[model samples]
Target: MSNSFSDMLKKNFNIDLNKQQKAAVSHKDGPAITLAVPGAGKTTVLICRTANLILNHNISPDNILSITFSKASARDMKERFNKVFGDFIKYDVKFSTIHSFAYFVINEYARLKGINFKLIEGNNTSLNKVRILKTIFHDVNGGYVNDDKLEELLNTIGYVKNKMIDISDYSSYTVPQIKNFNIIFNKYEEYKQRNNLIDFDDMLTLTLRILKSNPYLLDKYRNKYRYIQVDEGQDTSKIQNEIVKLLCANNNNLFVVADDDQSIYGFRGASPEDLLKFEQNYPTAKTFYMEENFRSTKNIVSVCNSFIKSNKYRYDKNLFTRNENKRPVTIVKTRDEHKQYEYIIKKLKQSDDLSDSAILYRNNLSFISIAEKLDKSNISFYVRDSKLHFFKHWVVNDIVNFLKLALNNNDVQAFENIYYKMKGYLSKAALRYVKEQDNSISVFDRLTTYPDFRSFQIKNISILKRDFKKLVKKRPFEAIRFIENSLEYGKHLKEYCKKTSFSYEGTKTILSHLKTIASECNSIIGFLTRLDELQALIKNSTAKKNNTVTLSTIHSSKGLEFKNVFMIDLIDGEFPSLGSIEAYEFGQVEDLEEERRLFYVGMTRAKESLDLLAINEKNEEKVFISRFINELEYIMKENDEIPSEFSAWMKIGMIINHKRFGIGRIMDIDGDIITIKFKSIGIKQLSLNLCIEKDLLKAANS
Candidate 1:
């Protein structure tokens, strides 16, 4: 059966199953198996392995299950299988999300145990918990947390059920400390159960609840899933992995694929540590090494190898490639953040892929300077995620136009355009809340209504409310006539015409797109609802190609690939993240490793090039260089691996002096930005030639 399966794969993929792939495909119906550190062909192998089973091994595709962390990746697998098998395959391939798989278990098992199985949409987010914590638990009870602390808490909840960290640690304290956290954590369950709402987290939690309660459901599913494959194995949380183990109980019938170094979703409870434990759980978990370099240039891969090799207990692989290193991956050390932005723009202004090119950074804060730089350069860029949510942004024109129209009445076309623009993010309930004039449902209201505001609902409501609110303010059929010629709508249309800002115009353009959309939608309301779904899918489809260089946080950069990745702020405080000085009693050593993994993520994003950048303040000068550059320096000095110009030019520093700011030295020298240290302000960017003169380097050269 395995041989016939292998033969079919050979006819389709043009490659027979290698020893490693054969083992993965032919594994006896066993509990769990890990395919460790395999290469570029892992996905292809998984697909073929499945095809082999369905075609020859006689396992019904319906009985086989596969899970992945992303819908996009799942879609990718579906396409891959379609391409190879001609789409006529009839096996029931249950390639769903882990949470979805778990939900199926509870729905099946809980019912047999006389437990009423309830259906919950995992994506529905409720703001009740955040609001409760803020008003009752956090402030009225304790106090409020700033954005960073809030982000940490959100990241923590995702981590807890995974058992990456224990919630019990916070149990010893009470009032406003760890005890307060426990109190909130305890209430989370109460809130979810009471609302009967499931967030993304509740799926895993409830699945575990059902499993513990019903052994019968467990047996049914264990036998139901004859073969299971998990992709992004590095990200499987503890509860998730345990569920898989239960379903595959004592059968080596499960295969897992992931790269330990690429495990960037740890903030979301994905622990790579479990990948390390596959051997203890499944003895024949053949660790295959796919060392062929497919994604990066040799130079980029080499530099990355040095960095990740620092991690212990890693599977050693021969990750060599026939692809030559086009250029030694360079570090454009910046003297400061501003300089980093300026230099990146100057260098990339003429690059072929500048529109496709990206400037990756440690945080969104770095985007401010770069966005300004691109704006000044007249370069246009759309943030990968925020591109379509044009209405959500504080576009002065959109706000003024919509507010004016609503204040007047249902002005012709004005309401539709605004509704069209907004349909991208607003949900139906929110639209209803606003239409009902639920002054209670502010942006704060909509945001908090669900764990994550389900996208479809928001648009459905925002568009309707936007219209109803206009009518509510205006009133009467006679008022409609008045609104038709109302000076307010005319003024809004006039203002829309008068607005010269490109961004504002972009909003207008979307309205025109919406008008066409509205034609199909028929009513202002129907078109708006469908328009919401269309705009969101378009936004998520792909990164827009525009001349402006993009700068985004690494977290936002996930599931995205770029041509050039510039990692700025590679210094200790910024990258490893100094974090809330409060959260770290000693300092974030873990945060630093996370930063290192972040850097790894940024580096891996590139197919051709990667730039490691950093900045610092010293002697009133803004000094910037790759901290990795220093590590590179250490390696070069130790091994005599330094390139001739690199040793001298890499060490080169210059001075920029302002009469008021005093002397500052160059910490980095990217094209336009020069890092300078001034006597009073310490280190910073002195916009090249803005209020500065170069000195130290000229003298040194002479």
Candidate 2:
């Protein structure tokens, strides 16, 4: 592949193909696979390879089918082709998504097999499942049946589906042993059949099932497709592999382009297992590795490599850049969660020059710290959070109103809201008591602690508690409910001002205005706090604007890269979150590995430098190095670099064993703890106790 392809590329388009692009173009026989990392010239390699095949190899573009993960990627590949090959290359060189290709192949061969199955859209699968669940349980959210069991089943179904468990196996279990499972599975399948719908999972699964049952259909597609290329192989599903396997029977004409390190779609049923097991299945498959990273500095690569090296099963690769090393990754171990938030907020103000800087966390709400400082400093941020609009005065800021009524113990408004929502459910006492009240407090406040709350007498405070809990889940709608209910209940305050009596209409107008404010709010949380400006909400608002730093979990930081990265909480309970445990002692092997991968991902997001920090004590703010620090040290030391000590990580614990007090374990693990297990003294519990944690780290040798 020489100047014909090169000339065609230059004539049609000008793409800056780096060494990687040149390498791919120069591979005469072509590669069986290529693994490209994020932001690499993978697409360039693709177009260049395609151009070479047409110009030099003299292969018909029509014979090769290129598959990408997204429509945007499909357009990208097409543009690259058009840019390089000009009008000389025909549009017959097809490009489609794997699912689109699957549909095409299935449809093409369905006729040959004399089987007629209509192509179904993906949304239909889940919609049908929901409908079946609704029909089987009568109440989808579990109002009709045993609430706990229904919620359990729903959670189980969600877990199994997320883990990509083949429900066919679970669906076939003996009914007597798995009666409930069978019921749900059967209903879901029946729902799909009746609705004639398919989901993303169904596309691959159904195709493979069809191909397995009908080999001729598979053969027809196999012969039609002379060469196939898969992009972002990291996100490929198990069913995807099965299809690829069926198509690549000869093994010589397959091209896989992906980055296993970037396989972040496991939550969406993608498996790293598919990529890991590829070579095992394709015994004669040749592999090539790409290590020259164009992004980030050498220091950034070093930090990222240090982190990813912990993941024992990753494909061996290194990332390096020629740029001068810049600033190092910051490490901060604050006193508490609040201090952590403060640190992050501080970084945001300081990171003005770096466009890639972002606050990341395990939970979406991790931006709370950043939000707080924005209010105090009057700093502007996009609020990028999707969880809730946090401002009080804003319409979407109903959480403030609801919090006023419930958490602040405002009874009148709470009752009024409940009554407005369900006046029919009220007893005679509830009606009479409502008529006697001041009607000034929020609905949440009134409902929980009304003088007449005793009169309306209801069993089990659980229902009210659950109702309140449900409100918390919908931060925006909770705001709406608070307004409607407050308006329904509070009449006196509305009517007190003759010039401007606090009437239902008046409150509705205020709330409606607030909603509009929320809609235009730069941040939901900031918007939520706006209601604090209102006289009614002023007394209820408690969160003060402050110049606080932001602290959050690395998980929350996905898609967010920063110039300075500070990753702490790399401990058993944090980086390997307590939730990561399966039994008491054993870890979920996959979850642990994923966390390590997350660490690697976080490190790579840094530009010039990186810092790794871990809690010094099992439960303290003092930052310390992780045990993995030693492993990282060994590598650097072998290269004659001095190693950092482990003493940096071990902080002192508060509850200690004296000869008299005997051995004791810290009961509540944090800055403060009251309860303790004393070996000599049976048991001792303390509240706001004298237990204190000191800043003493364990030595590297010790």
Which candidate wins on TM-score? 1
What would the TM-score be for candidate 2 when compared with the true structure?
A: 0.61
The alpha-carbon lDDT assigned to residue 441 of candidate 1 equals 38
Report the lDDT of model 2 for residue 98.
81
Task: After the best TM-score superposition of candidate 2, give how far the Cα of residue 91 lies from its true spot, in angstroms.
Answer: 2.6
TM-score of each: 0.64, 0.61
Error of 2 at 67 (Å): 2.7
Q: Best lDDT goes to which candidate? A: 1
Off by over 4 Å in 1: 1-39, 87-92, 109-149, 164-166, 171-179, 385-550, 556-560, 579-591, 617-626, 635-702
Q: Name the TM-score of candidate 1.
A: 0.64
lDDT of 2 by residue, 1-702 (tens): 475556555665766555655665566442355766544557777777776776677877776778887776787788767765666676566778988876776676667666565544323544444344556765333444332244345555543554546676654421122235656655765766675555445566667777778877767766776777888787676667777777767534777887777776554556577777768877666675556666676655665566566666667777656667545333433344444444444555666543445444443333433344444555544433233322322222233544444443345544443442332245556545654655664333334554544543433233554555554444553444443453332233244324431234323434433444344344435455554443223222233233322333454443344565555434444454444433324644665566556656666656554554434442122434444444544554443332221112312334455334656654443222235566777666642212211222222233
Single out the weakest 10-residue window by summed lDDT for candidate 1: 691-700
